[model samples]
Target: MENTKSRKQPSTVFAVVSFIAIVAVLIIMINLGVNTTLSVFAGVIMAVIVTALLGIPWKETEKNIISVAADCMPTFLIVIMVGMLVGIWMASGTVPSLMYYGMQIISPKILVPLAFVLCGLTSEFTGTSFGSVATMGLAMVGIASTTSIPIPLVVGAIVSGAWLGDKMSPLSDTTNLASGVSKVGLYDHIHSMMYTTLPAGIVALILFTIAGLHYGGNMDTAQQQLIMNTLADNFHISLILILPCILVILISVFRLPSLLGMGLAVVISTIFGLVFQGVGFVQLMDYAFNGFSIKTGVAIVDPMLNRGGVLSMSELLVTFMIASVMGAIITTSGILDVLAKNVLLKFIKNKSILVLVTLIYCYIVNFLTAGGQTVAIIVTEQTFETTYKDMNISRRVLSRTLEDAGTLSAPIVPWGVATIYVMGVLGCSNAYIPYAWFIFIVPIFSMVCAITGIGMWDADEKPLRTKKA
Candidate 1:
């Protein structure tokens, strides 16, 4: 901790100025079509310059950077594995089966609501919104195109379902990061989130139900026939193909490690790919690293299937590294805390305001940092843990807030990795943002709960902060 001793804390004014400048630069560059990776690099350069001007030694900054990166390494691995899971599952026809069967079952009358719920379940099982969107979401979009329902509405249902699943899933990297960073157990974190998630999910479903009823109609039978035929021609759609999904659910039900479960699913899918899909072992390996390619003559379906592989996640990984470096540099300079103490915490004395501030902080991090949920969680937890302790708030509450904002907000921010990936996969525009019902509801519900102390630990409970309590 000698490095900690060597750093000089900048005044609140300097800290605020530095933050605004960095955020402004990032936003301008991103909007100008500069790559998000480059924007993060620019932010890091600014952060380092601030540290140097503050007289903090570069070695101390290096140590902080390494420490934060080390903390994030597990999340990186999980995300990479999630990429592989998508690749293997898609190649194995597990995902294809799900899409085919899902399309076959849902009638136009209940399409929107069921699509939302189905995508949610798929994402919850897969633990990645990107994966859910690339597969199930793509299928929904393709199916919706043949109907009179608005594409934005369909995209909205898909995003709403996918993000909600990502928020609650035990296998989700964001969920794990939030809980781990906040020193809460994984199951405990998910359980706590249900208070807000369940209510918001129900509300979202109701809205979707109303939308489906209004927009529901008979889609072109010829178009639906062609899509189903393409899926059948390409994949060996069968009940057995659903096992991988079942395996993931069982793993989560039994409280197993997500890495293990996702890895197992990948292995099983790989074997299935070889045995059923006739994908060779060498090809399977290629698909795991480089992703699966679909050559179906159908235009709408090909893009949806053209996803997965470790390489596909390269952009996200680079974004993660760059943002982590920026966060580390700012943290090392001690500006993050100074700004937090003087600017954020100055007026946040009570639980209600504190909760709102935490939510806002997480959202700001997502927007400014390009929506790295793990980065947001780590930063928010580091910034707010002490405040929560002093306020007698439970860490579970902190965990829930981190997700309610950080995880949920990512898919709404146009430049966020999750949003970009989902949009790219679904081939939809930002028109869906206004329709992403669940994403908007959870945070508002969280703020309401915080103000009323609903679902929060009692202030007088001695063991309120304990994991087992």
Candidate 2:
């Protein structure tokens, strides 16, 4: 038995080492200005190395690769559809009308907080940070350009609001994933997160509001009106466009599947486009694939409103592929397992340390994976479930930590899926935004709550009794 274990250990170590080397090479290539396509190739190589090193039967790894590919196929279709939806919506005047109204309400003095609230509302309704950013959040960027606000800060506020809603909303995939992985009830997880999420959101709003009042500069009303008029010329703007968004919110509130809810919204938007804008089938198809382009002959407005389509999903696809493959390799190599055994388990002796360590580990996993928020929550929950139980801590606490750290941190990491999508739509860099104040503050605030036992259930709580029994 000892010899068998020893043989396995070497394979695991070799697998981890090889995976790390590939990642390092990819990083170097990226630093050296190699195209993103090459970076994805590097990730694929790393995945193969991990499969080989895991000592799984060679045929099995090949099968797994096929499975992974198959699983990813639907994502491609969804991405394409999303692109088309965005394009049609833009060309149909849905987006422009929304933007026109948004611009009328927002001035530089209130842009930051207003953006936060708007993004927050949209994300909650959409249940997808990516969808919200791609649609309305993109419009916010155009609106911001008419003001003297710092672009990055505006981007940050948008990110902050979107992620906050995504983390807290019952409809969010990450929220469900955290609860599911931890074996906690969905409502319980959401209720627990409110302790941290609400405080952080309030703080973020206050900070953004202050910044808007003090640092936000004047707006060019002429330029803003010009952009609005250009939008009016292309598509029919009406209150009817608001129905799709409202339908999304209603479906989400009923706890419907996120994909279904989003798909419904897409259908509504398409119908609205066809009926109101006289959009042809060919045009709709073209818009979805190539994105909507507005030829206003005005350089700035064209670029701003002329983006959306399956093609826009390219950067996001690459980012997801890289991060997912890396995560798969990490799982296969047992490096993550070893880290949890050696590092995470060691914290079980101290209640406070265990919570702190779990929070930190979840945060690091999110940063490294840069994939979906679900990946971090699942990994962290699996890593620490036994420890939490052993320490008599509630799983809800763990679930809460997962949200506060993992779910909220995705948008701050440049290569992360949310960040890449947001940046692509906004036409900015991830680094452009100051680290979202909410993202930075939420985890710290949550850790404080955990250590001080502020929001934690009492040891004698009924849930603990049921769990222990």
Candidate 3:
């Protein structure tokens, strides 16, 4: 499908009303306690109706929706594969081994910063904040509970670390989606994010270190030992168990195709599960489809280990489809174009204001859309691409900004899907918001980068463009 330029642009009134109507429906439906899937579907209906009212043909609108959805097919595949990878890694003892070793080495003095770093590493490796939170993040919570450390502080650290992976990981769907929609290379997008991510990470580490030192806990080493023992007793504990993870890292470093790398890694992990865990082929297949389950006779460890599967990704797949439909209709109907040209563009004439406004727009969409990063990134990119081109800025900056704001903002919104899912998994309260230092710091750091033109490129410079989404 071509760009929306060929489509008839609605008048400013029609465009503004259409955009507001969709947003209003989303806000109302979400506030009314409807499920996110339902809320987004309602938004889609509202967008379709608005476009019809604006005199766009239904068939044309449908074509646009289908085109956009097709573009998201790769994302859909990646998410499903991610669910599979998570399940296999768990069944193969890869994740459990990491958790066991991580718990053993994390001293009370470094527990807080270690929590951030460990969760970040897991998330970066897995490429899903929810996965990292559900697995290693839960472990952090368990560790904190056994110590005198504050659960909220640990939860904050986990959230911060999880988002680091979510933003920078090549396996991350949000990272890929942001880079994809912005028409930038995946590694390029990840590389650009380091400008803000690095400094924010350093600052967050300092804060976590200070907080840990001041309010440090008297850790119960016995509980930690128990966790390690239980893991060892239940699964084959070996450094070689993490070969799949190393495989993924190597693939990322080599700059190979992400889906291919992850797909092969999942197969290798499944094989490891069969060989080391001594499960039969049938059981491995079951685990791949329905997720791994661990009883371990230990209530706390069971939840941490028993997660992942192709089925686990179904909700996200549906949610992605719904959000994409709404976005597609908005773009196809030319409402995005109208609003951009008449409304947003009027104020974001300068590059500095453009970056700030884009960041703000990403946040608004993220929260209001209930924390679907794909919708925020794609819609933000689609709405602002022309403006960025007009201002002669690089699309890599746009991709980075999306990661900084859109990808990072999801977990901080108390009611957003990412926050709710992570909190539920880690058993942490929204009070951890103040402590999620990395995600919060990144956007501010990015804004400062924009103001200083630190990582951004001018029109006259080499433009970082890729094949259009």
lDDT of 3 by residue, 12-63 (tens): 9977776677777777876787876787788778877777666676788789
Which candidate, 1 or 3, would have the higher lDDT against the true structure?
1
**274-364 in candidate 1: lDDT tens per residue?**
8889999999888888988989999967765777788877877887788778877876777667777788888886777888889988877
User: Which parts of model 2 have CA positions greater than 4 angstroms off?
Assistant: 1-7, 10-27, 50-56, 63-77, 347-349, 462-469
Tell me the lDDT of candidate 1: 0.80
Candidate 2, residues 152-264: lDDT per residue as tens digits? 98889888988888887777878888889888899988888888888889999999999898766677888888888877877688877867666766877787765676677
User: What does candidate 1 score on TM?
Assistant: 0.84
Best by lDDT: 1
User: Would you estimate the TM-scores of all the predictions?
Assistant: 0.84, 0.88, 0.78
Model 3 misplaced stretches (Cα beyond 4 Å): 1-21, 28-33, 118-159, 162-195, 211-218, 349-351, 364-403, 406-436, 450-458, 461-469
lDDT, candidate 3, residue 258? Answer: 64
Stretches of candidate 1 off by over 4 Å are: 1-7, 122-142, 148-152, 169-195, 214-218, 385-399, 420-432, 462-469
Each model's Cα RMSD: 4.4, 3.8, 5.8
- The Cα error of candidate 3 at residue 157, in Å, is 3.9
TM-score winner between 1 and 3, please give it.
1
